[model samples]
Target: MAAPTPIDQITDKVERLLLRHEELQRTNALLVEQVHALQAERDSLKSRLMAARARIDALLERLPGASADERKERT
Candidate 1:
């Protein structure tokens, strides 16, 4: 059998590159989706943290020691 010509080799290479490009695009899309999901999760966690902090602050205000402001000023 005859060996492949230069044009055939170049065509093969181009096809491979196209396949690789498509693969990378798919991977990039998946990564973007993951980033969005993670960002949403992080925002939810931040909201929960803020709520917890508010609850803790309220509890501190109810404490019998000096007022919250006075305690902060002393520290």
Candidate 2:
């Protein structure tokens, strides 16, 4: 087999680098998509938590006397 010329070596190296760059680009895109999904999930959870807290507050307000003493006695 003939030894590869310098140009051949450079071309091969360039092809490998291009392939690596393309792979990294794909991985970065996937990570970004995952982050977007996670952010949406976090927002949903925050909204749910806020709604539950509001409901609890409303329930507390409806409680008779709305006092720690009444809560302790009920417990």
Candidate 3:
């Protein structure tokens, strides 16, 4: 069999590099999308946590004293 030419070796290397580049690009896009999705979910959870904390604060403020007996008597 004849040995491969220099051009063939260069072409094979280029093809492999291009394939690797394409795979990396795809992975980067997927990661970016995941980051955006996670950020949105984090923001939503933060808002919910804030609202829950505010509700708890309001309920505590409405109560008369530290003791449960006072709350029961008031009710």
The lDDT leader among the candidates is 1
Q: Which candidate is the best by TM-score?
A: 1
lDDT tens digits, residues 1-75, model 1? Answer: 999999999999999999999999999999999999999999999999999988877777777967768856743
Candidate 1 Cα RMSD after full superposition onto the native fold (Å): 1.8
**Model 3 score (lDDT):** 0.87
Worst 10 residues of 3 by lDDT: 66-75
If scored against the real structure, what TM-score would every candidate get?
0.90, 0.83, 0.81
Q: Mark the regions of model 3 whose C-alpha exceeds 4 Å error after superposition.
A: 66-75
lDDT for position 64 in model 3: 65
**Clash tally for model 2:** 0
Instruction: Give the distance in Å from residue 28's predicted Cα in candidate 2 to where it truly belongs.
Output: 0.9
